[model samples]
Target: MVLLLRQRGRLTADTLARELEVSTRTVLRDIEALSSAGVPVYAERGRHGGFALLPGFQTELTGLNHEEALAVLTAGSRRGERVFGLGSALASAVRKVVDALPEGHRATASDAAQRLLIEPETDLLSRRPVTEEVPDTTMIEVRRAVLAGHRLRIHYAATGQPPQWRTVDPIGLVTVRDRGYLLARRSGEDRTYRLSRMLAAEELPEPAQRPNQVDLDQVWRERCAQFLSSDHIAVLVRVHPARREDLLSTAVAVRAEEPDADGWLRLEVTYQDLWHAEWALWQLGTSAEALTPQSLRTSLHHRATAVATRYGHQPESRHLLPS
Candidate 1:
């Protein structure tokens, strides 16, 4: 209401009530409360009369200390703004936070914040993270439904399948590693939907069925563990000591690790499927070797032979230029 009054200038009780979806009496009572709190709110009596703020009135929000202010500013600098569909709102909030800080601390906080960076474009290997494209309108509706406790119907495009519409009881929205997910229940069964795969969405009039209190962190962890454990295949490999960390990072889990006779580390790791195992080992090149599961070794050998056949040729016989 304060923002509305400041933006529109002199809104009547009826107008304010209509905008806020409340009664005029409630609006009058709120105005009185604002006055008692020294908010500079006043009402005009004559025909062009309504509530207005005193001229040059600005609310001073002085709740944050210097370090707190810098943390808030740094958080705003991160792409977390893009995750929750609050980019513009976050920008406005940062401006208000800076404006509310004391003059002496403001410059120091702002300058210090500039020295920190979050989620840079490229990682150590110059590999950029792939960002999924989500429509703004779709995200807006999804967030609205989640906040308002309303059920949602979404046109979802799952991997290896065509798009389909589904009605879900939205539990909450979670952002992980630059990707957004809608954790919900469909037919009393827990389900997770990727926000990037949401082709379109609509908020239903009916309220969603969800627990009164939700621990999203716990829920996400459980779901991740379940996903990793389902339909998985484990492999044993001997990795060079220097490349052990690389192998561990790519594998879902390191089941066992021990030193072999040649001083290399023999590790057992789990992959989601055969293709996943093949692809991860291929990226390691000669730094690692597959020990067990002769199928994996054969697959890699066949792939290597294919590559050799394609590239192993005389320079005169090979036409490198595109025709």
Candidate 2:
């Protein structure tokens, strides 16, 4: 399962044998085993295709207790909120797990889970950790809209935006970490709405056609990849011995090198965009420096000045003398 997931494209009998450290005949037998176990294992006798699991073949979690079920749903919910593709799958799996929970503990556990208050770890740079619990009815409604290809008229609030009513064609429900999001199309744009921020949702009377313009999963993957790709402003930072963990925790797709004699570690990470990069540098306090992209240093210095001015003060005059 790990190999199938980690590897992309096609696989040959010999390739699978080498990867699994078994004979070619053994690889064929294992493929048969997967097939018999209802895995969509198929082989195409061509250069482009070989042994493969059918696309969208995933094990459903339908056998777990209330707490255990909640864990699975919550895990997927958080990740889906970040990457839109996994929302529908997570919702379906969560539903199955919820349905399978023992009757006596189901309702009580579900209610308790909904009321649970979670605090997001401040160490990461991903989307705000979804720690707030949304109502169960919202999840049900979102799922119904997604599966039935219905439009939803919802009142939603974005992080820095005012709340407003919008008509969205529900594509999938993404739950990242502690929050669920509705991935939908507005106008022609793909928009993600936090489930907790959705004040109200109702199925619209005017059922619209599901657009054939873009694949939701593909769009989600592209967005994530684009967001995490290394920035042009390659940065290196010396962490305060005390706050090294805090800095390391915020690096999403960065390479961190061993600390030098000074109690500071060097890291290689990209800024998603200028705004994101500036925000990250602020979080590092005096521990970070731009190893490249000289402009970032100037920008950070300017930002510091602006922020300090806000308090009727000037920034400290200790700019890292141009290295």
Candidate 3:
């Protein structure tokens, strides 16, 4: 109740009751309780008026415990405030988290947060991370539809396809590795689209067709299972320990792996297609060997032979390093 008042500036009795799923009497009781508890809550009498806090009024984290305050502070700091195009709101939340802490512990909490690091600029091999950019307008509209239970229309350009108009029942938004995606339903069929692929968006007045409540995390996992199981080309390869991550990173899934007597690791992994498998293994050169799929081996052999001929040098044994 207090949070709604603080964020919305003013909310009527009906608004508060509806938002909290409580009676007007309960809201009034809470308002009285807040005032009695030394909060600067006030009620204005008029059609355009409602309960509001005093200008510049601040409150301790009423609903959140002290530990939760620290967690918010840490998360906000780590995400750098600008996550999923909500930088300003996240910045405000972080400030609120800092202010909510006890006077003596605020600085200490901030210092503790600085010591933790996630998703560094580069890995052991100095490879950079991927960060996809979504236009601000597209994100704003998509978020509005998802939050307000409205249908969303988007101009999307999927991979290898021209842009098209799509109206969907927006279920939720997800961000992984800084890449944003919209999980929605189109024509009663599940669909997922990258936020960066949205050229434009509009929030429709009609309500979304999804459930009033949903287990968004569970839905995401189910969709991921379907996506990974579709037409994925499985491959078996032996990779040098030094480039294990290089091979694993490109593959969609790793089903099994073990170390051979020669100290190389044999991995059963899946890629998007045969071309993708061949291209990834070929990049490892002699440090990796594809053990299955004669097509992949033949493709790599031809490429290696062509490279050797261009340099007027005899290619080494076809099986990569000697067994």
Top candidate on lDDT is: 1
| Candidate models: Cα lDDT each | 0.82, 0.63, 0.81
Model 3, span 76-157: residue lDDT tens: 4434223357654544455565666765696688788688777688887788877777787887898889889999999999
Candidate 2 per-residue C-alpha lDDT over 35-54 given as tens digits, one digit per residue, 9 for 90 to 100: 89887778788667677766
Give candidate 2 misplaced runs (Cα > 4 Å): 1-130, 159-161, 205-208, 211-217, 225-245, 248-279, 282-287, 299-323
Alpha carbon lDDT at 299, candidate 1:
96
Candidate 3 lDDT score relative to the true structure: 0.81
Candidate 3, pairs of clashing residues: none
Q: All candidates' TM-scores? A: 0.65, 0.44, 0.67
Model 1: per-residue Cα lDDT over 1-323, one tens digit each: 67566645799999999877689999999999998988989999888999999877776564554434433543543465577666555544565566666667877887987897777899777878766678988988898888789999999999999999999999987776677889999999989999999999999999999988899889988877777678998899989998886787688877788999999999999998889999999999999999879999999999999999888986566657988
The residue ranges of model 1 lying beyond 4 angstroms of the native Cα positions read 1-78, 236-270, 291-294, 301-323
For every candidate in turn, the CA RMSD to the true structure comes to 10.7, 19.8, 13.2
Please list the residue runs of candidate 3 whose C-alpha ends up more than 4 Å from where it truly belongs after superposition: 1-83, 253-264, 309-323
